[model samples]
Target: MGVQGLASFLDKHQNIYREVRFGRSRLLVDGCNLNYLLYFSSGLDQNHGGEYAAYVTLVESFIAALRSCDITPYVVLDGGSDVTDKKLETAAKRREDRIRKAHEAAASGRTMCILPRMAELVFIQTLARLQVPVAQCFAEADQEIAALASEWRCPVLSNDSDFFVFDLPGGFLPISHFHWREVRQSGSRSSVSCRRYYTSSFCSFFGLRRQLLPAFAALAGNDYVKLRGIDWTRFVQAGTGTEACGRLEGLLCWLKGLQESRGPLEVLEEALGLLGDLSGDKRELLQNLRLGMEEYQLGRSALSRFFLHGAPPEFPALEQEAGLVPGWMLLPVTQARLSGNVLDVLRLLRMNLGFGIETQELPSANQTSRPLRQVMYGLLLGKDRSSPVVEFDRAGLGPISVPVEPTFTRTSQRLRLDSLPQVALSDRLNVLLEALGVTQESLRLLPPQLQLPAAVSCYWLQTAQPPPDLQRALLLGMSNTPRSTAAFQNKSGIQKVDVDVSHAFSQWQACLKDAAQLNQLLGLPLPEPDVSRLYQGTLVHQLVHRMRSGGKLKTVLRSDRPSEELYRSLLSVVRRIRTRRTRQTRQKAATRRQQNPPEPSADLQRLFLQDEETESEARAAVAMQEELRLQEELLQVRTRYRTKERSNRSKNPDLARKEECRGRDLL
Candidate 1:
């Protein structure tokens, strides 16, 4: 329970201790060996002696001390055990196979190892399982741990002297006091001294880190046998000796077996997750490690498959030909790559127009004698049906003939204003102009009609017209007719034509009759008016027509005496025309109905006959007595005759008469 040292360390490094508490310590541990020890110690029952129990207690105490000091600890355990001896043997064989693979990799001049080394795997697995809040490495655990300690400026925790080769930034601290005592007793005073001795001894004995460790090991010797002072030099030189080959084979087999072991898989996944979560330098290292592992496991052939085909050479070359600097050239290339052919053509036009052209090195110096002609040909051609040519003055260039080619003779011309073709250019020209900072007045100064050839002009002509207050009024009546019926309207009241003159003139017919009438009334001897007068007259007529038809005639006629008279005349004419139109419409409707009359039902016809008789009697009685008496007598005689006729007709009198006639003819 001695905890003074632990408490002191925590107090001294409060920030470091806080980080550890929050799981931020980048501590490395030996997983496989720790697990083995834990299991071994746990198995110690009273029967197998109390020694294991004591060991476990001591280990637990040490862990508690570490926790109290805020030193997060990770533990590693070996896979081999007494009960799994056969498995261990098989695993060892696999390890040797991996070592041989590593040797082969080294021979092939690759920096990769064949398998995650035993110690490295232990450290990685322990750190991963414990979820130690720090960067960790596995496979050649001691080496990686030392490397990590150097990277983090932290201490390395291990009894292995091999870690000294890494030159850890915070130095080394052995886990066991007994080991420290043993080293001290062996005349190594300080940890640095001990480390130096270990480094020199190992390098001398095993020739470690000589170009490539695995290859050298494969060629010269084995550590286990060499450390034991066994002479295997001749066997190594021959490259066919059993001992040297056996050791190398064993080492490779052991690595392969470790790779197959299930313990490393979870740790590898955790490492991969950490790698994914990392950024900057840490992430890069982890990535390199991951790649190395992949290379080790899958071999170089698999690694080769990950590379893509090299980019085409002509792309950069084309950019260079465009007289663009490296970075600037790429933008156009990118634009060209993504845009449709039409856009590309536009871009080329802009480039030619000296829009984005800056003086730079052309692809060839010999070609500099000729002026660079950059003109947007697309601007001369319509992008689509709706495109229009934008007119602007060309700037910064004198007439020069551009060489067509080595075969065709150069055509010398003033880059004639007439040379440009007329075509539909998009409004995008304005944007380009703005970018160029060119003013409209400057554009106007260009040669007369410096008309863009192949460019269709879409010009709009605006006319200045007086306001609505100056508009004249015509009169319209409820009968839908204009009162004055003037063949022409007066232009004197018209202030202006707000819209384009061309548009107003196009609708000139609507006001033409009004114009003729106005001319007749005014007695203004006029020939066929010009477009301006026509537009002006048209505007006046429209205003008058609108006022007359706008349903405010009383108010419109109230202002002026002359207007009232005119209004009345127009209204009278409008009403007469409307009345005639209405009558004609009604007559047509009535005639249509009579020609295609609907038949009356039987009941209606009977009612009509009864009513007709009653009416006829009433009318007879209302006449004078004598006239009435005469009418009544005549009616009575008519009725009697009508009855007799009906009877005769019904009894076949006609047939009888025909028979009598025939008999007379026979006689």
Candidate 2:
């Protein structure tokens, strides 16, 4: 369904397409494509316990691999199909297949909806939790991928081969056979492995350029096109003798010439001359191709949003901005309680996003019994679609606020059903006690297994006192709500026959089986499966395990094992970190040498800084030499005075006695 025969062409000439891979390249990912691979890898689950958790785990692992290799990933998922698309019939066929599967699952007592949308939701939520940029395309993902790749100037990573036809300048990378590509230096330095591929190399080998790819793609039918009898192999066989490949290259050049002027009628004349003699039905064939080209053009127009950065109506420039209240708002029974209600249900709800809702206050009802419920309905009704809007990380909803953004807003400007944005989702859950009007502690008083199941049991019980077992079955996701009734009771007095409990025991058994399968799928044992982790784990099993009642159960006691893939990923990350550290150290040393020219050795360094012991040795030698010089001078002076003093002493003994007396006085 991708470019027809493109895979075979690439396989036939694989060796000529060679390029070096970079660790830090930007990659655009096809989220749905990767999720299907993971889903298949995880054998079919018999039960649906923690389905969201399983999806979150697989996606996180794949993302980790991309990140460990230093790739900046931009994830994109397919949104609801375009109503005006040329391929609605194909999309409908797929939906019918899902409907059939849903029926079959219902018949088999499987409560979980195994549709692809659930997986898509899980993907979007996981990326949101990680604060990663993700976009959901309004229609087919192929054109959007091409458009965004062009805008972002990064390689597209997808299993689909439609990218070759899309004619991206950067080309696409298929990760279906993803592995390390070893690149050796021109000299005998060394080789290193990285994940990379270049599709342009393949185009060049086939004697095609970026501009000519879409023409070549048209030759082989694509999703939006249905041209016939223009296969590459057919062109290869059209030439005479051993020069057929050269003739094929000539054909490409002719096609490129036709496209230079960009006029359909003018190109049609040249196409007729080139293709006229190829077949007896040339006119009909060319006409069919012309129609296909028109459709492709129309498809591109429909998907321009991907290339167009959203420019909403201009908002008023603000003089100042509001700051986030990072601390929790402790809503005691006073503020959280409704007009007449005494129990505080709002306190149990965590206003996540590390920010509060930011909107104006809804007019409060003075006399209403359920003022909070009235406020919620008013907020939902007051949402404006075309209002000037600004995206904020955290906005307090101290006033009237609709959900900050709609779920499908990434790709879609419209929806069949208004999607509620602020709700619980996979891996990052807003665990709210919705409609459970009771003390948080009182709700916790139930047995551990009974707590979550009790919420569902209470819903059906209050409506019609249906047995707790049916609610338990419904809550476990082991049985579907009968087609006769709504998913759960609503404003209308919706009623249902008692849920068939013939398979209640079997359903419980299936829950255990699904939990076991998740472990097998995860291929490790960390703790007995906790369903809530599917939502609240934040993708860390260790953290989720600690949240368990038993407090950090020994992993060894559960299962002492490691996965090879896990270790390999860890090892790759370790190598990357080591390489980074080495590069930094080398750069630092180079800078140091540039500044100082030479690094001093230990002894030289000591001399340069004047160590105390070395300084003391030099000081001691100088002191002793000075002392010797002074002693020598004193001895010489005494020798000169000695004879004169002796002569004087003989001349005057009495004077000597007086001098002796003066010396005694001086002493």
Candidate 3:
């Protein structure tokens, strides 16, 4: 997709990328890239609102995270997939494959990574609801982002390799590496922590001038132009760190050598002429170079401003609205007044998104469903504003003032969220695991039915493939494979797609064997994991003994003392198990008390009343909880009196409360 071998080439030959901080700067986001990011990250069935909510949350958090890092975000979405004919054909083929997968997923009733037809609209609507700045490009988002970044002097945030073709001065920061770390030895021989992949920096590192970038790309070939004719094996030989002046001529010499009769000059000219006219990888450098020029010429960045911020076309000729007015606006989540930590921000977002608010907003369950869009629209409208001052002096009217006018502000332009930090994509799923009170060790033992759902629900940008759930499920062992699945009908019957995980199981078993090789190498008396030394706590015991002896523990214990060591280790294990059970018993008692407060029997109560400290804490908790109960009763009385006062006010228009009532008491 990028210069064919650019990524690998840079990694092997030199350190091309450097980590740089861009605090308080604006990032131009590629919305199409983020849409796929969210789709793949979600695990809920498409039928569930939670799936949609996850998509919305990802976009919200992505912006929030950047803002938290002091970088403002401007989202730009693609208008259509129109592209060069060759690229369009490739995109069409991929789209067909995606369509087939979507059909299969629909039958199975699970989430798939296909971007829905409504995705672009849904994205725009979500951003509208969130009050974030967003733009829909007339063509590709890449062109818009590249052009905007260059003109605005900001970094384009994306993983798409083609941005390099824009030759922008402001540079590009790969979204995949927003918070990358680096390791390097210092002059004191210690690594100290310190960027973007600037086009200028990249060319500098490659020992090529900026102007030669097109030439370099042509030789490499790309999505639009492909290498053709020869294998290109041994081309641009590795470690050939020759000077810049020698590089091009060296390439010419290599090409001329390939053809005994042809002169170097003719070889170069012929290859350059026919490069982009065809498709396919070949050994000829000039063929690749020719295609590169064609691709470069097609770069669309020059027209970016027209799509992002050009003057509106004459209304009579305007067929559609093309751009969003640029600026940030506070979302309803901000009204929740959250401090923006991961959990708090997530809670606020869900509340505003209609997941949490509905239960609380309506007084009773018998009430009809409230359309979320209506509430969202009201929240998005924001507070009313007084009209701007008349300022007749500017028109030379001499102190003229107009009647008062009231207007409502629709959008807010804020650069930052609260001081609280946002969670990274890598750590976001860990929050869910923490809430569930599960650790990495329990992953392999999770039940089968819950495995896939849990795995999918937690899938994020950094989720590993062949998801751990599949591995965990395979570990629990398999059942008799279903020979045929029941057929189902929607408009037509759909066949079930059966998965064969036997190979995966075999692969896991092989992995287990490799791990067990340690035990086998030791030649212990115990088979597999049964050896006494395997779990022996002698190492720690010896260290403790040594400390007490003012020397060590290992010395007092003879090397042959396996029985004593085994006994100590087994005893330690027993203690750990008992402690785990005791903690679980206390947790259960606490949960029961929360569900239904009851005095426990002597034996049951003693389980949690383990020590003086615990008993004191329990007493404190009981005493403090009653304070809220009393406050609630007081609130009920206040509400009763207030309603009575309102009723009196409505009846006579003479009640003391009439002047102060915020809402009319007509009812």
Candidate 4:
């Protein structure tokens, strides 16, 4: 998503980045990047689910390290993808690549660098616990991060190459070089050692105007605009980091040649001229080129007021800004209280990337949670809307867009998206409970945090393909069940990620995430679980293995009475919900059969001639199975929707294939 080969090119020049003993100032951190760096850098489990507690400890240590050096950190996170569809092509390619890598990682036993589902939630919660100032922006936080850093006269800490192009007064510090864990003390002062890059140094090295960075970035091909068919390698000077850095070096050299004589606008025009004849597409290309460059233009940070006054940043204006997002949701969306999937639903585009350890052959784990997301979609877009949400989900080794109609229950139909906040708490709770098919009374016996998870598990059991066995349900309940802090202090040794087990847990987590979002949208009718307490990869997988080896729950829990009680209480609630659902399904089936009875066939007459009680029991069982199958089909989104090709149809498939080949050759 940055200028191609820029990070490596800069890394080769030691003079461009000066070593600094960093401390005693405000540092703006890219929170999403930090989350990825922290989790993957620590080599925690990525296969099963996540080792969130250990990840929390790592975050706490990081914050403590910053405080020790008197360094103040203000973290910002990205909310959702850009609604303009500017980066849709890049996103689709990345999604396809991720799904392929995930399958490979699942088959082979390598770490795939996939951050678990709840890692973000755990990170945000940990920051709150440590009293670190943090904000999640409505969209990409790159510009906001750069803006805040410039205003504060402090370095932006991140590994993103886009930061290299942003004109920051303070500087840019790549997280790869920032040694927060290695704080050094020299008598009176404590400081962390790191490398810092000032835009001044970069501009000086390249002999170009600092303002030309945006133009330079666009010409080199970023996520926003990839100028096809123009090869700049022929224009580069021989042996000036050209072979190693690819086309970026060539582009920089060309920019340097025109720096003195031409302005940014002229350079853009001349660069577009290199593409030769575009016929009718020239204007569109020029507009896209300008749009790409506009990304690096900076202004006063909108987040300044957010950090200073506890106010959410105002929604930034978009190209398509009419009713794309409801005004009421802007605040919660900015606060990071609501999930980004909300925006995805509203925009009719759901970008779902596959997990690293999921079994590709199995039905996507996301399918199990379709019902939950459907309710959420209904709440966002009115109940009566017929438009389907186009979901870019991983299928086979590629990404496919499935058009899924949002399920609007009688409960969901009662409330409208705009007036949801004005609704009574009881009515909201009823909507949430009915959607999950549970009662408040049923959830009362479990811990507050476990209630939503328990309900999700019940829903999963009822709808999951090849319905989960009792043991699987019990393990899921245990995973959601909270344990003592001491129990999580030591991590179990790394073990191979079983694709089936990993996929199962992935589905459970998906359901929990959607349910949590639904609750948040419904004014938090149910208590939101502490994400860290919900699941731990190593512990849960180990427990499953122990149970499979004929170990009892008490033995696996080390005879911890309170933990066992919590596990049993959660399991009981889930079982009760499942039982009630089955009863309702059977009753509905009986009513339907009575309303439209089939003529008695020979087989039915033969069955009726046998024992009356046995025939009735067999007939009831068959009807229940048929009814359940039909109900599951109704709940599952994929079954109801038709899949479409990748949305970026403008790019020829053959040309894209050639580009992939060319990319490898350039590398």
Error of 3 at 628 (Å): 44
lDDT computed for candidate 4 = 0.75
Estimate TM-scores for all models: 0.20, 0.43, 0.39, 0.86
Tell me how candidate 3 scores on lDDT.
Answer: 0.38
Clashes of each: 72, 8, 18, 0
lDDT of 1 by residue, 1-667 (tens): 0111222222232222111111124345454334333434343221110122233344555454454445565432221112212123343444344434333332343323221111122223233223433221111234334444555555555545334333444544433321222211123222211221122333343333322222222222222212122232222424433333433333323333333233433333333453344446555543433432222121111101111221211222243234321232222222111112222222222111101110111111112111111112222232231122221111222212132211111211211112221211222333222222222332221211111100101010101121122212312211111222222223224322222221222222212222222221111112212111111223244444455456344543444444344333323322333333345665797697688774678447757788886775465345334343444443444455457656865798765464334212211
Using TM-score, give the best candidate's number. Answer: 4
Number of the top candidate by lDDT?
A: 4
lDDT of 3 by residue, 1-667 (tens): 4666555444443366775555567777787786665556554323211233345556666555555555667777654233234454444445344444544443454555545332333455466555566665433456557766777777777767776656766677665565422323334332212246777776565445555456555555666565555434444554655333233333333453344455434544655554445333334555444655545443334434433563221211122322111111111111111111112111112111101101111121111111111122122222231122221110111122222122221211111123102323223223223322233333322222232222222221012224223321221111101110011011122222222221122222222222222111111111222111111111222232334346522323333343323223222222233334346767898798788776668557767657975776576456445533444443444455457757876886743453333112100
Ranking by TM-score: 4, 2, 3, 1
Task: Give lDDT tens digits, candidate 2, residues 1-667.
Answer: 3765565546545564444444567777776676665655555342222245556766676666666666777766664333334564554455344444433443454433343223444555466455455655433456666666776677777777775555565666666545423333444333224333455665565545554555555555666556443333434434334333533344454554454545554554455564437665766666655655543231232223422442111211123311111011111101111110101111111111111001112111111112222222222222342222111121122222223221222112221112322221210111112322222333232223233333323322333211223332232221111221122212123111111222222222223322222222111111222332322111122222233325432322222222222222222222233333345665798697788776457547756667785675576557545544544443443343355566888897876675444312211
lDDT of 4 at 503: 74
Q: lDDT rank, highest first?
A: 4, 2, 3, 1
Model 4, residue 332: distance off in Å is 1.6
Runs off by more than 4 Å, candidate 1: 1-27, 37-56, 64-147, 153-155, 158-201, 204-231, 234-667
lDDT of 4 by residue, 1-667 (tens): 6877788878777788899999988999999999999999997878778888778989999999999999999999987778788988898888877787777777786777877877888998788667788888877889999988888888899999999999888999999999999999988889999999988898898777887888998888789988888888766787665236457767877888884768788888899899888887888888898999999988989999888986677676565756667677766776676766677666645645345466568777777877777777777778555477777776666678887777777667878887777777788888888888888877665555567877877877777776655445344435433444245324435457767777777877777777877888887777666778767777777666656668564543554654544554455456556666777886897698788786778448746667975666677577556545544333232222212123332346864464344212211
Q: Candidate 2, 537: how far from true, in Å? A: 18
Q: When superposed on Cα atoms, how far off is each prediction in RMSD? A: 45.7, 33.9, 25.7, 12.3
Where model 4 places Cα greater than 4 Å from the true spot, the runs are 238-245, 317-320, 347-356, 384-386, 470-495, 598-667
| Residue 129 miss distance in model 1 (angstroms) | 14
